[model samples]
Target: MGYLLITGGTGLLGRYLLRDLMDRQQKLAVLVRPSRRQSPHARVESLMQSWEKICDRSLPRPIVLTGDICTPDLGLSPTEIKWVVENCDSMLHNAASLSFVSTGRDAEPWRSNVDGTKNVLEFCDQARIRNFHHVSTAYVAGCRTGLCKEDELDVGQEFANPYEESKVEAEKLVRSCSFFDTTTFFRPGIIVGDSESGLTFTYHNFYAMLQIAWTLKQSLTAHLEPDGRTNVSYFRLLADGTERKNLVPVDWVSEAMATIIADESLHGKTYHLTPRTPVTTKLMCDVIQEVLNLYGIQFDPVPADVSTMSDDEKLFYHHMQVYESYWKDDPEYDLTNITAALPNLPCPHVDSAMLANMARVAIAGRFNWRDPRVAADVNLGVPEEVNQPNVVKNPS
Candidate 1:
């Protein structure tokens, strides 16, 4: 009967979760921070409106709590806090910093992943919200090879990046909390765009290579061969063309999580929202080469020698250094919990054609480096008062 309070409602997976949950007629409230250009309410309004346009139906908006997860009480005012205490009984902690590197413990990957989680736990304890749902990455397995079960968290494994390290710490923090009656964790693999639309808002890990190729294509346009292909023959990727990357579509991840969250019996367990069949590096590269008209990229298992590398290859490797561990190979993520929960809902296979479609979409949008800030197309039932910045005024 109480509203489900969620963070990270503006992210790619969060947007899909909002749509799927709203369709199921769930009472929801979202805690979102204001951007420099838009207020929290405005941001949610824009997101909901965008969904409405895409789905071709009117949708109800969640109660927008203007707050930052990194702040105490999530920066909510006394009145806002009272409303949440009275209305929200469960929370989905989804806001996270995806920074792969950390300058210090005080900076990102720590600020949003660890400290932000602590702040959320503190608020929940204060508000007496007992049920908690956490969004974690499957990579928290952290360079561990072979099968990674849903129930496992820490196995004395080493982390490839700071993002994974911070997530492990956050998961430990969440599990350590004793106030919650139910705790659920959804560990999704690399999230790509929608399976059907191939549309995505965020481009980070998987898109890095595609982006690099696209950028090179633009600058090297004059050197294109008669076959409309750009010569990337000198560039060699540090892989055997057999490394598998577990990619889950954002829509599927949202649906799987929503289904589990909606059912009370399904609580208190971990779910690996990953694909049954992982896509290989060769397949991904082939798609990129075909879609982007890139030619002659060799896959070498050994690390490239810096002395013999071309300028383009050097630039590519430099830009991709942060995700070096990410590209190594993904372990097999066990889908025991999610498979049992949603027997009928199978993860869409991301075949080469599908991957190509996704690539085309990204290429068309030029990788969307900046937030487009698309305004609400229809100003339906959004309360006028919520639109004003005073709805949750910043503390003076």
Candidate 2:
């Protein structure tokens, strides 16, 4: 069997995909960028160890290639490039920037998502890799409401942030590339922790809200009397608690994508690895209240101006400004392609119970801020401490 080249093998979904592919005894090559404290090989080894612990079984190791996606030829040496071209027949491009705010035209989200994808495509073209798997996001539908079909790429819609816009551009680049005879796009919804264990390395997006809720609980508890109930009025935009947020477990996405990739007939199609029934904003709020033990939590419309808002409301908004777009209703994602491919495969329901479990895990892990695995070396462009939550790091 020809080796498969995977990028972002250390990321949330990438880790799961690595495990699945390894379990199938597939030979793999992973392109990993060197971190500040560890080499590319070390990072892949650490993640493999974590997976072994999670599964209680040894996994086949992947060949780690030291490279940067934003650079030409993936910053690969002539020997490394030749080795990949000789050994690899398929490429899974999964690395991307998750920053919501754009620093500039040449900075993150744009640099990594757009430029990095172009570089990967160039490498694939040069290497003569015919099969390509592009990991994308369901939010590529952008600000469009209603159902988003699997085949649609650009709908002339506005994006909530630069991240969405960048992904759309990346997908377009992949589609327009003519070197690959078979290309598959896997678009997943908001990916959280594992469904069973709730284990996750990074905490942003949905988890960011949980972190803010934890912060609010901490701040309010410090000010409250010993037996006083913590009551706070939360500010929400014009949402009436009916907006739906599609959340999928990381494991499901990886498994589904792996299954699709293994089947040669399933190539050359876009699949939405999304939930059948999306969780509502109201249900999420109720679960948060239950998990954090907050009483008298009320959601009010965001004022026209921040000048009249209370300090607590202002702090909450400021902390969650980056994810404000997620608070809005998500467009319906059509999963007909996925369902037709695997009729028996069903996406686990992300109900209130699951949300509670995820919240508990986040609270226990402290949003992975102090975890040794994550603390070893934070991803590029992510700060050690984020005073303002207007930026998202390592988005899935």
Candidate 3:
């Protein structure tokens, strides 16, 4: 009678995970923090209603527990704690801070990534949930080149940012917990939109470049020629165009992780949810140029001096400074674990056309630039707009 307890049920991949698992009729419960505008149960209802709109059917809802992962005992009441102890046997830790840098020890990347994970582990120990699943990023390999196998973690490699460093510590903490019967790790690469629909609830990583290109295109309108191509100043990127980045779709990652979790035989091993063949930077730039009708984004083998750069070039670098390390070539990810577990479900190849489609969708949606749509007063009866999953603002 015990159910699987999931954290981060409102995140990008978390939404898809809920949908995929619910489709399989697996008993589930979610731990969600109340937002400023909505209670915990209201947020879960909104998420479920959004998924129902997507599938065009009614789906069973999971019990919602109101709690903040960073708080002591996960901010759960005594009764709620008792419910978890009595009704939950396993857990999936998906909540995390995605900030690339750390402002301070109490600030992001550490607060949510490290401290929050410690709290979750404490709660798990108290609740006695034996099976633990942690969602880690493949970038935990951190600035490492060559082949990064599934079993590899902390090889004295340098990190590109604080986010990677925090996640590595969190994974180590989970592994250090001695009471767990099974420990599983899911490390996914740069996650993009859905393969079939090209729809994404969250926009980061690849979308960052596309958004910059779109803004650049708008800024240099007079430079545009009759052929609709802009004769803008070329911005020199740090890397050559040949570097490849491992990008994977969200749906594929969710499905693969769900499959492994449902089968107890696949527990206790790390799974790399990465693409077989990664996409090159040149191809991504080409797709952006073709979709946005903009050009002059050239790559240089060596770094260019900032003083010698043009105004437009400087502007590009200024905006892209945070994500500078992300554009580097990724290592060949060993998919031995995922490949064997889900032979029939293969990772979708992200070709130029697919990238183009995703770029267009992001551009058309205005890169999810909008005000907070969820109001303080929410009607529980799913409204017409609430029925549309795309319009449902993510609380995370």
* RMSD of candidates 1 onward, in order: 3.5, 8.1, 6.4
Candidate 2 lowest-lDDT run of ten: 387-396
Off by over 4 Å in 2: 220-229, 234-238, 301-304, 369-396
User: Runs in model 3 with CA error above 4 Å?
Assistant: 220-222, 369-396
Could you tell me how far off, in angstroms, the CA of residue 41 lies in candidate 3 after the best superposition? Answer: 2.5
In Å, residue 240's CA in model 2 sits off its true spot by 2.1
TM-score of every model? 0.93, 0.90, 0.91
Cα lDDT of model 1 by residue, 113-198, tens digit? 99999999999998889999999999999989988989999999999988999999999999999999999999999999889988
Cα lDDT tens digits for candidate 2, 295-341 = 55554445336787677767777877777777778999998999999
Q: Tell me how candidate 1 scores on lDDT.
A: 0.84
| Tens-digit lDDT string for candidate 3 (40-121) | 7778777777777777899988877878899988887665676677678999999998999778889998999899999999
Model 2 TM-score, all chains together: 0.90
Instruction: Give the better candidate number (1 or 2) by TM-score.
Output: 1
Judging by TM-score, tell me the better candidate of 1 and 3.
1
Highest lDDT: give the candidate number. Answer: 1
The model with the greater lDDT, 1 or 3, is 1
* Clashing pairs for predicted structure model 1, backbone only: none
Residue 332 of candidate 1: its Cα lDDT?
85
